[model samples]
Target: MLAGIKSAFNNNYVSAEDQGARPLIANRTAAKGWETFDVVTNADGTISFLSAANRKYVTADLNDHTKLIARAATIQAWEKFRRIDRGNGKFALQAVANDLFVCADMNLGGVLYANRPAASGWEEFTITALSSPNPGTPDSQPSTGFVVTEQQFNQIFPSRNRFYTYAGLVAATAAYPAFAKTGGHAVERQEAAAFLANIHHETGGLYHIVEANKANYNHYFDYNSKYKVVPGKQYYGRGPLQISWNYNYGAAGEALGLPLLSNPDLVAQDPAVAMKTALWFWNTQTGAGTMTCHQAMVQSKGFGETIRTINGALECNRGGGGAVPNRVEQYKKICAMLGVDPGGHLSC
Candidate 1:
């Protein structure tokens, strides 16, 4: 069952209205026959939502800016959606046909449309399994399969702010499925330890939300990038990795389908978003180095390579002003906690 996040709709479940076209709307107060959808995970990893209303596949109509309608007779490209887990049982559906998120657009009287470039509050939905005793209630359990357990994470970052939740990090891992799951158990634990250690250094044991240096806040805006800096918005260091610069924000926003270029505050505001941004940089970006932080770990390149990929410009070899040694110590400590060997080449 899919429920809208907008206040105007009052978290109503989506209903495939029975009529000529069977348009999808977020006005149902309860999940019954028409409100339920069978989430089909395709062979290609894409998803197809089969509406229980008419036993038809949900289609994002390409002719109408991808308006969601349960009228497709068979599964096609327009029926495929990428489910982006937004932590806490919420998810955003991105239409494969348009490469846009499906939004419960309030402007259209709660009609669903796959037209949003980014996944904001409007695009988010709570998808509950109907098999549960309480149909609409989300599962209370934290997402599973992550290498780092909540207990282990809490023990690692006991001083972490409430915003940096273990659940949020677990949920963010869904965005990059192969994050700590890539290598074998030992390597996976090493990767998790390395990532947590880096974040610990950046956030000062997860105590800080934003960069502490206020003087450098306004300096992150880039005048020459394609991503125009929005006036009054500061692209300061934010999230676990503290992603900075207008171009980085824009690029991450584009990849994650969030308006980070304009609403950079989302990274600091939403815990799940913050973790997602951090994971985005961890799994993709190779800032100041040759390989991504993820590659540095999974490829057996050592923890030092991870540091180089993250902050080599300042911390690789030029003494790192004590930052490099601190990172190494933290990595070793975390590796010990996880019972994994702190592999060689511990310094960049």
Candidate 2:
């Protein structure tokens, strides 16, 4: 489905009426920025067909042989092709780049296809009817799940990457019970990963501690900050996870048996503090208290929504913080990459 969509957008196919004819050759010298899909140059002034998946390259030479680029061991026999209309003014053509069947859109510049990585020219074909190893539905989506196998877990934990290990996960689970669980599909891991990915993207990385050498090393807030309006000594960056706002710091400090009001910065440095702060945020469900825009999206849409929200937020704010864009062309690319509906949030 994705390949066909990409192929259509790339203009890689021919109609039934134009049977056995070749596609127009690309005049561009560099393959880096071909405007349409599969718009590759051929040696004899011909062109090669590229797919959206970047697989199955076809050429007019060798009598238009259809061969898999990766394997190159098998050749598809030439056969007569047909076209079938799929309603909505769209047509499904047969024998695409390498005689593959496809239902695609006509190429339009700066459209959805123009935003994809393969937009620089590639051939794509619909192979949904093909069988697979699992044999249930084609699961082409790249899983963003942080749930790693034992071997995978061992590879990431107890070291510089400890932030993703079970130890790091424990704090997140303890702080945000609803979001983080001990077992399978813990919403905590998802939310934490989303949070971490966001902050990392915002501030550089997890190890980029803002208050690395403060007397109150555990807190995240700068007590000496010129903008400090709060009175308490620890009212800077309280709680554990997000170490939210000033008022919430006092409230969380009182609830969690800490001087969160006196030294808030602790949360950003300590994994335990960060976890607790995050928990408080989820538990209270207030923007000032604990909940965030990201949390809201997580509750409503899931990880993808959270990431999209963050992406939009970053793009709109240019790092200054503001309203996020509801629609972005890259979002469609991401949705297509994930094999999900790009029009709305996920059902879960």
Candidate 3:
């Protein structure tokens, strides 16, 4: 459910119009069946707004000035939005097709358009959760657990490689039941945000599947560690958090019951295995810090500590160059999307 926030159209709710080829409009005085929409979180981490009135997906028609219409039968790029939370109980929908904000154009009789360059009064909308007995239906609200929905994940990393999938991340959570479920709701959300922020930093907004500099590919081998490096394997950075080194691969492989030390490419090839290796480090390893990343958030040690645990040697203190600030900024952005306070001690 979305209601317009433009001064003159504050009371109007988005309506699918009269089905058929009619475009969505923001002139409905009351949010009834036609005004209600199902916020569908897709498996690929994008979101689709399904009109409850006609059971059709809303689409940003690129051929029609990106006018929003409720005529799509299936979810596609044009049907998806990167929902942006404004931290004031309002949000703006950015079309996945054009990376433009959806605007309720008052000058055009409150017609919805995905042509706005930025979110403002005409692009802001308030969402209301409607109660429903059937939880799987489109009208049901999103779950409170984990906090990062597939849609939000897609929103955070719009340009992420297809390999770093949201489904893989969810499946990897099965390995560590307490990964993001340890603390209360807010803590859970913070922990998720912190981990993803670090991952975003490491993978360059999830665009890289492996380390970019090929020169560093063979430099992560450690001979003194208990886990022996395989004869021909190279344990360079891979996956969301870029699990690196021979010992780390050996340990992660042993824990996840995979031949990661020898078949290190699995971390880069298999999405679930890649995510599992990252989670293995988050829940278990302390790296240069004294506590695991999980322990940092669950114990309210702040997001800074998580960064310390992950790469304190290179990125903590004032040694990080721009890395630390980038991670903190990403964390704050994710927290804003989740509607949670990015607690103090933001930087190391």
Candidate 4:
């Protein structure tokens, strides 16, 4: 039965024409995102295979009448797959939605969909373990289980080490999973680039930790007293993402296990805490926008939407070409460096 990790087999079972999430095929060869699948035990004794890239479960399309799609975030009646064992390392994934088995149309190069009721050859698939720490090819196409590597991160930022010490940045790698989770928003390179670009703009290529021009840093404590009651401490802009205000300090502190509310200076002094706060804000906060910055980039909503997500109410397109353009330009440049398509939606 289900014991270890397994990757999707996309050997000629899917059409070459179909790509991305549409064709819904899997493959091996040490890829990160697509090649990895986690088997989960359901309460009803059934199982689910969650894709590492899309972060969704294999679901039978209720709207299209059994059209199989791997885009469900939760396990519902339509999402649970009945794994029927036919022995010899073969199993058929029968969809609970229509009681139909997952059939890979080999004729179409393997466009996965639900159509058959019986466990046949097309529905049968083999499971294996996952092992691909090899940074993935190009780092563009979505892959899982691979860290960007210190060398690559340094090369990307060049002078990043100038602000964040090598030891500190390396230590932050432990927290990389928070942003690059198997089913999280920052899993994709485009999303990663968009995040870095915004943070880079905020911190000037990781050169500064605290805001330099601002004088009334302590004003944050008085103006937003509802967040944290720090009689004299100032929760000003600090860290790579410049986490500011008492509310943000409290939230970031709570999220990263740091007492930012009591000692907001930790964000300015500690590189790991600074980066963590930045990533925390990027991955979770919606601010004035409808989605998180991670969601904006992952969903192809453009870099502009990220701006909106960060400070849309004031600094968005309405900033009169003051700040939003700067972020967009930097994001585009970073995308160019990464060799991944920027994928439109550039402005707020």
TM-score of each: 0.59, 0.37, 0.62, 0.55
Error of 1 at 96 (Å): 57
lDDT of 3 at 60: 96
- The residue-level lDDT of candidate 4 at 106 comes to 65
In model 4, state the lDDT of residue 308: 84
RMSD over all Cα atoms, model 3:
9.1
Candidate 2: tens digits of C-alpha lDDT, residues 118-202: 2212333322221221222222221322232233234222232244334554545444555533322223334434444344333
Best candidate according to TM-score: 3
Worst 10 residues of 1 by lDDT: 1-10
Clash counts per candidate, in order, are 0, 38, 0, 14
List candidate 3 stretches off by more than 4 Å.
1-146, 319-321
Instruction: Give the alpha-carbon lDDT of every model.
Output: 0.80, 0.35, 0.80, 0.64
Give the range of the ten consecutive residues with the poorest summed lDDT in model 2: 67-76
Which ten residues in a row are the worst by lDDT in model 4?
11-20
Write the residue-wise lDDT of candidate 4 on 1-348 in tens digits.
Answer: 112232234432221112237536533334444544446556466767555445456677868756666666556687677888878777788877778888776675566677887866677776654433224312322233333334445655677635575456446646655454433322365676777788778777777778876786766664545665687787778887777788998877887788889999887777777777887888889988999887776666778888887778878657457888888887766544333446777887
How well does candidate 3 score on lDDT at residue 77?
85
Which sections of candidate 2 miss by over 4 Å?
1-166, 180-193, 211-245, 263-265, 288-295, 298-348
Distance (Å) between predicted and true CA of 206, model 1? 0.7
Q: Give lDDT tens digits, candidate 3, residues 72-184.
A: 75566898889788767777889999999999898998898999999888888877666542232333223534456777789889999998888888888889989878776
Task: TM-score for candidate 4, please give it.
Answer: 0.55
Ranking according to TM-score, highest score first? 3, 1, 4, 2
